[model samples]
Target: MKFDQKSSDKLFSKAKELIPGGIFGHYKYAVRNEGPKFFSKAKDAYFWDVDGNKFIDLICGWGPMILGYNNPVIDKAAQEQYSLGNTVSVASPVMIELAETLVDTVEIAEWALFGKNGGDSTQLAVMISRQETGKDKVLKIDGGYHGANGWMQREGSPGTIDSDSSEVISIPWNNIEEFDSAISTFENEIACFISSPFHHPTSEDNVLPKKGYWEHIQKVCNEKNIIIIVDDVRTGFRIDLAGSNKAFNFSPDLVCLGKAIANGYPISALVGKNYLKEAANKVYFSGTQFFNSAPMAAAIATINELKNIDATSLMNHHGNDLKNKMISMAKSFDVDLRVTGVPSMPYFRIENDDKELHFKWVDNCLAKGIYMTSYHNHFLSAVHRESEIDLIVSLASKAFEEIIEV
Candidate 1:
């Protein structure tokens, strides 16, 4: 299943001349030394590259395409909006409907604010939290990727604020003790504790909140009058229509969402209660592109489709089958590979390998037909049928045997 490499090599050489990393987004050269394979077209749960090689899509543009690639319903909605003049002079009527849908669907979302990307909504949520709480610092989960923007990247990127800065404190996830200590240490300065519902990039397993973790944190934050911001950029909509909070039995004061919204369209939402939303009015929260109607309409249509088809169940079924089969096959090979996280989404990594070693295994999988942007994370969408999951598990089994036997 090795794909033809000539066209992708040429494309990468040309792209490298224009772009510093020969790519435009995250995990560009991190997984593959040459760069990820370039796609020519995608339909349903599969994608074809410039070399005309087809493969099952496990990434789905980093989990945004939950309804699969080029879904007709969402595509038709976007096309109709374009026909009626995309981005109108006056406010789009669709925005009102989208807000209503969000308020009605999500558990704690009373008011919705729109943004173009995940980073925008996260920063906006942080701003609103700060404004409402009048605090300078925010407590963040270590290794949880919200987005590549100010409030997120500033803590760990090449040149930005230090991790222990006065404005933000990055603590490890699943460590309630550390979370409590950080809050006690920076109580007055801390505006909120913003975290991804599922711990990503650092830990392998989802390890969801350790039973009443959120409840305890909620109690502490409420007692201290601190806001809790759930960064649901990756987990929202896909985990549930209301996001992972629905499963966890916890509600945050504010939530930032993207990726799964609009079924891959460029839209992010900052949802909060009316009381907290009023703080947004006091601040200068504004974006020209945020009010675009196409993405908002697409989001409404996307949610409607998700509700109609029970997408969460479909996704979870596919992901769980893939995980179970892959792990079972890996065990047959006498390898210690483990799969972790929610059934709808899972992360994979070799137990006894360093970053480079694990990436080599992943690169091997890529050469065989699999595509995962990160070393550990792979997203499953509703488009991935049972056959595709079986195929992936079979390939992964062989790949694991080859990697571990050596």
Candidate 2:
């Protein structure tokens, strides 16, 4: 059966009248004919659109639904906290509890700060680094995306001025020589180097850190007193409960975590070593909803569930299986496909740079009831079972057929 997006189309028309650019930001309708713009409901590993077209979700709510949509344990925790009260005139006990849990769990965390989004956490990390070092320059990965904020925006994004990135230095990922050269050029003026544990740049194939690459970077940072910030907003708990720093066996001065941390709740954390506590205290990072108890409760529950179930291992196993199946299927059809990044955060691409073919193949998959994006890495969740994996492979096989036919 084909997708019926009549209801979705009507909503989009109304949304265009009310909302700017029909839809704004990263989720804007880029593809000519994509899936529904609105979803009616979501359960474990699946969601239904307004027109009632069901899909086996592979995007996992853009990396926030690690435990899966409408997770009972996480929802119950949030609901219980909501019953008590979501926000108050002062901070809630759950906030302290969550902070303590984070410090205990994350390797480099001796103190924790809360925020409402990944952007907030990342911006705060930079602020703390600058404050601590009394420096102006901040280094970043060339193609990395920290957030939509001015300093983090790509070179050509609209409304971003030169001054926004004047002090921000961009370097290639997993390249020690380039990193060293940037450090030498900036010297003591550089305050911090911020990056994701792995390179998952938008619209490009993801990349893993080379052997000894992170070690060299960490060594330089330690020797030169440069603060290191790991922006694990998209790969935090999904990769390892403690943080990707622990999984990768390197330490960062500060870590920004969001997305999967609270299982789709609006929460982000800036965790750092005890040495930066004074600098963190000096920063003025605050939001009304940042102190909300519901998301903190959800995060606590999510972390506990992940630990109990060894969710990372499960997801990695399933993700590897999915990757293998896709590669094998693509070979059978003589379609060029390359899969990269970590197992839990697999990124695939059609070898040819034909944008139209990529879009058509992705659209075909959407039509076939599998939700995957061509522009970003696909996420896996603890709730994605073997049956779902099998279905994803079968759907991808069909999608490959469409690619070859095109």
Candidate 3:
């Protein structure tokens, strides 16, 4: 059964008075769904809305919930933390323990600071970089998503970045010369280089760094005393307990960690080396809600679970399997499907001029109890099972057949 739009619309109408557009941001408005069908509950890999229409949840809370929604162990740990009087005037032992766990597990994380969102952590990283390097300009990839903060979203375009904040420079990804020129051109004025290794443009191509690209970049940053900040908001625990940093075999001065850090709970961290952490000390970086205990407690449990299961490898395997299956099936349907991404994450696209057909396929999948936003950037969860894989592939096969007919 489908969710009743009338009731959902009622809730949206009521919500709009207090919350803008009846939700958090513009993306919520972009959702073509008639109304927000609130989730009633979720299990390992499936969830139902208030109207009780179940979905496979391919987006997986936008790349968190790696261990799955309402995970038993995580819930039990959260409950235990609550039973003990969640927060106190003093710090919880779990906080330091979690920090220690991060530093110990992540090779580059000599020091760490926790926060409530990736935006916070990333902005903090920026603050630390500026302090450490005494530079105001930050170089970022043109389309990279660091967060939604002013500095993060401020672009070279009009109404984005103004002359006062003219230090911000946006460049294309994977172009070594462009980066080198920016560094040499800006020199001491450039403080940091923040970027994501994987490019998730609308094309769904999971391009990797060219051979030795990272190593060469690292050398350049070292030469110029420019701090490197890697935004692993989407890749953090999903890529590894450490992040894409470890996967690429190159470490950054400061790392923005988020998303899967707390198994879908709102927790993020800025892990940096000595100088960077000291730089943060000089800057004013504090949030009242950042001290909230629930997400921290959840993070502790999530880290422990990650250690116990070597979950990154598990997620990688499942993602690879699902991607390969879909690729094979799309080929059988005579569709040029380019499936790409690391094992932990995967994306797909139809190589054709008919971009509208992409949305049609997405809608068809949704009609069949599959929840995918678009084929451009989809992900896998650790909770996804072989049975679910078979079902998704089977449904995708059917969708492709129908999509290619016209």
The numbered model that scores best in TM-score is 2
Q: Which pairs clash (backbone N, Cα, C closer than 3 Å) in model 2? A: none
Assess each prediction's global lDDT (C-alpha) against the native.
Answer: 0.80, 0.89, 0.77
Instruction: Report, for all candidates in order, the number of backbone clashes.
Output: 0, 0, 0
Find the 10 residues in a row with the least total lDDT in model 3. 29-38
Better of 1 and 3 by TM-score: 1
Q: Tens-digit lDDT track for model 1 on 1-406?
A: 3556778788888988998878766646443544345889999888887877676777888878989899999999988887886777788889999999999988899999888898888888888988998888878887777777655774555756664344778888788899889988885888888988868764455556788788888899999988889988888876778767778888898888899889889999989978896898787767777778889889999999999989988888888888888777777866566677787778876676466656666766776677664455677887887888888877666666666664
Better-scoring candidate (lDDT), 1 or 3: 1
Scored by lDDT, model 3 comes in at 0.77
> For model 1, what is the alpha-carbon lDDT of residue 190?
87
Off by over 4 Å in 2: 29-32, 353-355, 402-406
User: What's the CA error at residue 391 for candidate 3, in Å?
Assistant: 1.7
Estimate candidate 3's RMSD in Å.
2.4
lDDT of 2 by residue, 1-406 (tens): 3578898888888988999877787778343355778889999999999999998999898899999999999999999999999988988999999999998889889999999999999999999999999999999999998998899997767899988999999998988889999999988999999999999998888988888888888999998889999999999987888889777789999999999999999999999999999999998989878889999999999988999899999999999999898888878977777888898888878887677876777788888888888889989999998999999889877876765753
User: By summed lDDT, which 10 consecutive residues of candidate 1 come out lowest?
Assistant: 27-36
Q: Which ranges of candidate 1 are over 4 A from the true structure?
A: 34-36, 154-156, 161-165, 202-206, 353-357, 401-406
TM-score of 2: 0.97
